[model samples]
Target: MSDIDRSPKAPDLYVHYCEHQGCDNWGSWGKSPSAAVATRWWCFEHFPHKSFDRNRR
Candidate 1:
């Protein structure tokens, strides 16, 4: 077998999102099942609900 074939397979990339509404940010959010379809996704400006909420408040 060639070295190319011996190389480890790349990790499967999944669609991740924030658990907020009306958000479609697909990326790492330090959450599990990161690739699963999420209820919502928060953009950089709308991440970390606690902070986002406080800012909105």
Candidate 2:
């Protein structure tokens, strides 16, 4: 088989940091309900959506 490159690019290597101010945790969870809504990233502690209450605001 011919040689091929399957490495992740620079953007792919980027780590999304928590959007919360003064927080530097890795943003592993993100929400983007619709195209019009901007994506919000946050760590487990800062994620607004809780397991017990999805509609809590």
Candidate 3:
């Protein structure tokens, strides 16, 4: 067998910040371009397309 490490590495943790200018809130919402990619992240207040149920929390 070859001496190559092929095991999957631990997932990288990324802390996304809001896309709005000067906003420091943690970006908990993600806008996906398609099923495979998330193009932008935003905080609850700055997120444009928030779900109705999300507001009830």
Off by over 4 Å in 1: 6-9, 27-42, 49-57
Order candidates by lDDT, high to low. Answer: 3, 2, 1
> What's the distance in Å from true for residue 55, model 2?
6.5
* Model 1's TM-score against the true structure: 0.37
Q: What TM-scores do the predictions have?
A: 0.37, 0.61, 0.55
Cα lDDT computed for each candidate against the true fold: 0.56, 0.79, 0.80
Candidate 1 least-lDDT 10 residues: 31-40
Per-residue lDDT of candidate 2, residues 1-57 (tens digit): 447856566555878999889999999988876688888899989887764255433
lDDT of 3: 0.80
Q: Tell me the number of clashing residue pairs for each predicted model.
A: 0, 0, 0
lDDT of 1 by residue, 1-57 (tens): 676676468788777675567666764544323356434444566567575456544
- Candidate number with the higher TM-score (1 or 2): 2
Off by over 4 Å in 3: 1-12, 35-38, 50-57
Estimate the TM-score for candidate 2. 0.61
Highest TM-score against the true fold, candidate: 2
How many clashes (backbone atoms < 3 Å, residues ≥3 apart in a chain or on different chains) does model 2 have?
A: 0
lDDT of 3 at 56: 41
